[model samples]
Target: MKQHITRFRLRSVSAVAALLFAAHTAWAVDPFTVRDIRVEGLQRVEPGTIFASLPFRIGDTYNDEKGSGAIRSLFALGLFKDVRLEVSGDVLTVIVEERPTVADVDFAGTKEFDKDTLKKAMRDVGLTEGRPFDKALADRAEQELKRQYINRSLYGAEVVTTVTPIERNRVNLTFTVSEGEPAKIKDIRIVGNSAFSESTLKGLFDLDTGGWLSWYTKSDRYSRAKLNADLETLRSYYLARGYLEFRVDSTQVAISPNKQDITITVNVTEGQRYVVSGVKLEGNYLGRDDEFKSLVKIRPGEPYNADQVAETTKAFTDYFSNFGFAFARVEAVPEVDRANNRVAFVLQADPARRAYVRRIMVSGNNRTRDEVIRREFRQFESSWYDGDKIKLSRDRVDRLGYFSEVNIDTQDVPGSPDQVDLVINVTEKPTGSLQVGAGFSSAEKIALTFGIKQENVFGSGNYLGLDINTSKYNRAIVLSTTNPYFTQDGISRTIDVYHRSTRPYQDQGGDYRLLTSGASMRFGVPFSETDTVFFGAGGERTEIKPGTNIPGAYLKYAEQVGYVTYSLPLTIGWSRDSRDSALVPNRGRYQRFNSELGVAGDARYVRGNYQFQQYVPLNKKFTLSFNTELGAGKGLGGRPFPIFKNFYSGGLGSVRGFDQGTLGPRDVTGSSIGGTKKFTLNTELTAPFPGAGNDRTLRLFAFVDVGNVFGENQPIRAGEMRVSTGVGLSWISPVGPLRLAFAQPVRKFAGDRIQKLQFQIGTSF
Candidate 1:
């Protein structure tokens, strides 16, 4: 019985011990304070990095809350894929598996884009190399690649990206792009263009079907910008005519299945054409009704010219604006009588509240100072805004040549409807030019020249020029300056000092040169909106260099010619041009009449020249221009004709079929003869280059020139004139204007024939 009780007690004790062990196992988790955290399966990450990511520190409790937070933070860093926390006794360990970093990015078969450009595009979307690799970024890069291709008209381009994992926890990305064919213009059709023929209307579009000159003009390429510009041209063409209500309804651009061909269709609405019956003005004319009425160019019983109407409205507004009416309005109310198909315009003017300018701000001049541009303004701060003066200021700034572009913008002052601030923006260009040229002519066999000129000296809009020419026929040194506005009231001033020597146009056994040195000052004052009067006086000294070439008559008068003479000249001129470029005037009228009277000089004379040039557009393929110049020189006070002022005509500027300065009367040895009076008439029919399409920069022209020089008192006769007609090619090059003409003499006298081919550089028409 004793043995049984002992065994039972031992069994009970054993069972109790077993129960205690099970309880401990269920209740006791290893109490741990995170001593450190370690990361595994990482080639680029450090152990301390993993520890730094833990939320609980070495002596802190590591429970599910802290452990879970540590793991969540590690995963949020995007540097790991797997994260876990383990506790052993009083130590905790944090483990993480790091993601791969991008090693390098490359492009394959990408000829359309540069490597750096693709890299920049990818970088914009977080796909740059050395950043963590993500599948989303790679997909975005592919889309961006395709978008860039579309901008270049490669609509069918394809892009693919590949991510390759390499050793050392790094990845490499590759973008493969296939740039398909470029979209080309297959057809461009215009509808509802009845006023102009289809061929004529189609010629206005810059984007066109493939032509032989497509390589140069690139007109066969489809571009959205080009289509929009073509629409504007169409509108302008119609408005310039009588169609004032023309509109572009829609434009459709369709691409083919292959995405290599495109078709464009333009739909327009043609409106009724109207003629002007009469134009009447109703406004507060400021007691100058008659003066304002004369400014109206829209006459009675004439075609309704949109240009004329706009001009009339502008004139009225300008007059009011000049009187401090900053907010002026001029409306052209057209009264149409359909029965007679005539329109009468009543120009209604309203001069809204008048106010002075608060301030003038200058902008867009990155290289120029504010004062440089502000000085050109005619309308000052705290002064009334004059539209006419403002327009004149803009023109003055444009003529400076320092600015590539000049514009004036008016902004209304906040809370003041009648007040405005003017802002002048100018873009600066290279203002200094160095010109060096060498030419060979019959008169000046080998001539070399150099010129240094600055149109806008230091952005001041003042001119300084120095020119030197050395040749067998002539030599000169000139220093000149011009201030477009010397006075505050828009008066211009010019100063010149020059020394010139000219060899007489003679073939006889005589050498004659004239040495002339002079200083002149001219002041230009506005006489009207389109006219200016220039008056000046200067002193000149002429020293006749005696040589064997001197004519007998000139030598007889040379004894009294070597004297310092004081002379005054007065000139009045008018100009009105609406061409986009002054150097190559296309459609404009230029007229001028200049008269110079030599008062109180050794040789008294009066010289006058009247010139008129008109440009007419016959069709899309042709532009006809005509120029006429009539000049007369009369001796005053019983003085003989000045031999130094004789006129010589020929060469590229006059008759191309003749030599330079060799077209007039000649000596017995076939040399040029100079005269005192001249007359010339020139006409040209300009066309596009054969294979150059309608490139405005290159043109071909057929011209006819008729002119001659006569004695001072001789009668003008058509029989005594020389006529030449020829075909010429011209180009506006970066170096300047270049021309080459192949001419034939239609009518020639003895010793009048010259080289059939003539070429010139730096010449403008």
Candidate 2:
């Protein structure tokens, strides 16, 4: 049978509708064996693409069902704008109109986002250059552009897409965007919060109506994600304070007609506050009930705290998993007494069948090597699942600083309840940094410094660093490298080479100079997860040239040890850090001890130093910190402590009000000659910067500093110690930690050089 106008056009189309139309007998053709197959309207799409989509091949039988299937399959590819099939005397011809290829994508009038950002958003919706163009795709692109603006509180933004057809069946697309004023949060109201004042409850939220720092924090911007998070915070605040049944009933966000202002209202119910009556444990505890009981954190007669309940349950589950019960269940079921306003908790635990790790897999390491990450894992394949070891392994990987995220997933083996697989997933990040800085001062004229470091060299977990400093008074070039995992057991090896030349601190040229050149090798042995001991040996050569204004102590030492001296120094150091955070530490302690011995050298001596730091969080917005450093040196084998190795004090890191390296014994010419013994104490009270709210990156601190350096033969005394108190600003800037201090010395000797104001980069105290 033959039919006229056999083609069926499709638009805003559905494959099912096309299929049903072709299946009708009135529009279908009789079944026949195909003699040949051909594809039409192919500009860039290959002929094989059409052949692959057809249900039946050349010389194959053709029927109504086969033709319908063929048409649906071709349309689903999205490569064609229209498709039709014709059958004449057993020869099947597939005809299609290809969608126009986008020649270019351009954006205009977009000020908030970069042009490339908008293009990427368009590409995400399949409307970029070289892709097929259609009206639906254009509409999607416009919607995506508007969504991007909406996320930034630009609800009034508009988008217009223009398509221009060019030669060769291609089109040039342009998206014009208009971003209006951002919607500012004008008011926030808490409808029903009584236990705590509305101001107190609203203070817990990061979002606010407006503030002086709003331009920087953008806390006045309205976002659904932020609102949801703030609501969760509000809920948690009440739950922790014994409000057991607190809930948010509704949240309303209202916008002005002009779309420039928004108002938010949250309705909440603050339930009755209850105190904990008792805590009881139920279910199996693996016969270690005594050990498990010690993990309970709930305190009877105290207010009910959801944090404590959660901690107790998680502790039980982790303990069970530590004993190979990987699938453990733990819950805190509460019994509430409404009349007495008291609650009791029953912790239920279940230890399922023990599971063993059948295999361990690692993935998502595109740039890093497998061995680099595998060596950090403590959990092994074919071993009983130990949750403690797995958590330690994850922490060790995170400490490597190579990955931004690390997760360990446990999967049960099919048909085997006792076997599981562990998959370690890692997300890699850049581990290299380059720092450049320049400073001007009266002593150093124009100083410049550059440093480059790579913590994960070639993804082998090695460290390579270079430092260069150019200044009038001091110049140095240093090169260093370290292999953190030099041995299978995690012993580290470091090698360093450096050359330094120092002159007296002055703006003009100096006749005297001190040149030092050396190389060293160090080995670090980890004593524990938080402690490491390092030992090294170095060979150094020091040359001293005599001229005017040189320190008298230096001349005396050089006369005894000669103008040139060579020394072989042996170094030993130990450090332990349990700080919770490296920046803006709230609570923690750090200690370091180092000793240097000139075992075999022309100028033999011994020196040792110790440092301690402690941070105590006073509250959410304030911290009390203390730092103390002590140093003492002595002569060994009848030789004095090397004058060049003397310690200096009274600077930004020490007594801030005094001049840099100026608080010690002075020569006849009044130049500071550093001392062989040093003692300094620093105390600071840190709080959030004014107007910044809870932003931790910027803070203000008030500090008190006491102590000074002592000469080799002088006895240390409290009367001689200089004292200063001041306020300062601490910012975690892009370059480094910066501290600016304004100090006034309350106790100082007449000869002391008072700086009054000083600042430095890259030091905390």
Prediction RMSDs, each to the true structure = 11.2, 3.2
Could you give candidate 1's per-residue lDDT for residues 323-385 as a string of tens digits?
888777889999988777788999887777887788888888876667667776788888878
Candidate 2 residues lying further than 4 Å off, grouped into runs, are 1-28, 115-120, 437-446, 503-511
Q: What C-alpha lDDT values do all the predictions have?
A: 0.75, 0.86
Give the local distance difference test score of model 2. 0.86
RMSD of 1: 11.2
lDDT of 2 by residue, 1-765 (tens): 223333322221234445776666556567789999877789989999999888988778888788778888888888888887766666777888898899999988889999888888887888888888889999988889999998899999998888999998899998888898999999999988888899998887778887787887788999999899899989889989999999999999999999999999999999899999999989999899999999998889999998889888888888998999999999899999999999999888889899989998898888888888889888888999999889988888887888889999999899999999999999999999998989664335587999999998888889999999988778999999999888998889999999998864432234777899999988999998879999999999999878877877789888888889899999999999877776768899999999989989797999999999999999778999999999999889988788888888887888888887788888777877788999999999999876676788889999999989999889999998999999999998876788889899999988888888787667777
TM-score of each: 0.66, 0.94
What is candidate 1's local distance difference test score? 0.75
Score candidate 1 by TM-score against the native: 0.66
